[model samples]
Target: MLHLRVVCPAERTEDVLRVLRAAPGATHLVLLRGAALDPVGDVVEAEIAREATDEVLSELCRLGVDHSGGITLETIDTALSDAADRAEEAAPGEGADAVVWEELIARTGEESRLSVTFQAFLTIACLLAAVGAVTNSAITVVGAMVVGPEFGPLAAVAVGLVGRRWDLVRRAAFALVAGFLLATGVTAAATVLAEGVGLFGPGVLDQGAQQVDFVFQVGPFSLIVAMLAGAAGMLAMTSAKSAALVGVFISVTTVPAAGFAAVAAVLGRWDLCGRSLAQLVVNMVGIVLAAWLVLVLRRSGSSVGGRGSRGGRATARREDNGRPLAKG
Candidate 1:
């Protein structure tokens, strides 16, 4: 369930009330007329079922409430009311399976941006993985995996492809490419500096007796693991089951491969460096491809689930026209 707080202009309050009253999945409606001070409007609140949220939000957006007033949606973690149960039953599908597209797009937009924090996390993770590669420590590699933030932009790319938003696709792709290049370059510089302090030997890249050789080794299993991890990561992101992200992080080798490549370059191990580069590319391609496929499947399910609604066709028309279908 979602708790919605809508600020409606004085003249548009009736339209807002009608939208809420018409939605069978909306309950516990409350209205405080002329209560808003800053924007100066009526404050309307209601609890809405997740399955019915998209259409209702689209309607509200079409009414120009977003431009004239405001609408805020919040998840209700614990609503112990019979009204809520009835609302859920009145909705068409399971709440967990529903896709709140506005929310998803907003979230991925923020995550995919090439910001300072993104750069810092990527560089730091790569550096940590480089240390792990030099020491041949599996523990350190896992730690780097847990710290990497590359999944956000990758997931954004998948979302962009599904939504047909080429701008989002371009931004995410640029962020991914530029981020990895910057991280690898920084890691290589760090390796050179560490060697100057006598922390790394010229023979550090020796393949024999290495415990974490898997970091630089690409095989069929690398593609398989990346594909599985990509699907799981998409599920975790969309379903709000964030705990599963830790498992997804540890299952892929992109960060470790980048770190290993950087370290190998510093040590003049061209063979290991080339292999690590290949491993990095393979993992990234596998992940993006798998994520895109998962999104296509989910989007198909959402269309089928919404097909029976009376207003579904109208909503689809609005979406096709690039009109205000839950804009922003």
Candidate 2:
């Protein structure tokens, strides 16, 4: 379930209360008139089922409550009230399958931003992947995959496309491109340092025991695997089934391939570097394409189901052809 706190202007409090009372998925409504000091309005609180969050939020937005006052949403980790259970049962879809779009946009907005922490993780993951490639350590390669922050930007791109947010798409694209270039460049420089210390050699990457050597080899199968992983990753993200992400981390070779290419470049192995670069590019393209496709299908399916269901529009407008009914 989700908890919502709304500050409603005196004139609009009745409208807000009416919307909440009319929603079967809403429960435990509490009204504190003129209690808000910051926004100087009445405070209203309620608990709502996950399946109905979008629709309720859209109604509040349409009532001009968000603009006149404010609306805050939070997850209720544990709700002991029987009303909450009844509210969930009253909703149309499974809680886990529901998509809280406002929450998703907020989460991905933070993840897709090009911040220092994001750059640092990408750089470190690439460096670790580089070591794994040269040392033939599949374990380390998998570790790098798990540590890589590339998925945020990739998912941001997909989510942006689904939400029709061009600004998000541009920011995610910039972050991904700049991040990979930075990480690959830094990893290459680190390889030079490792060579000087006798820790890395040019032939280390060519060793027969290195299963990770395939990171530099591009094939049709690589694209297929990357695309599949991308789809699975998005599904896991949207459905809150995070445990499925471990498989996604291990299934794609993007980070490992980029690391291999970086190391090969520093060693003047242009042939290997070219192949690895191709592999990296192919994997990224495939993953982005697949993720976008998956999100599109999921969004479309949700829209269709929402429109056909009663007492559960899930934020869709009655006359907007499946668009959320938020007023400006």
Model 2 over residues 10-66: C-alpha lDDT tens digits? Answer: 889999999999887999999999899988989999999878877887677667665
Quote the positional error of residue 94 for candidate 2 in Å.
1.1
Candidate maximizing lDDT: 1
Minimal lDDT window, size 10, model 1: 303-312
Worst 10 residues of 2 by lDDT: 319-328
Q: What TM-score would each prediction reach against the true structure?
A: 0.88, 0.88
Q: Model 1: per-residue lDDT, tens digit, 139-202? A: 9998999999999988888887776665667878998889989999999999999999999788
Off by over 4 Å in 1: 207-209, 301-328
Clash count in backbone of candidate 1: 0
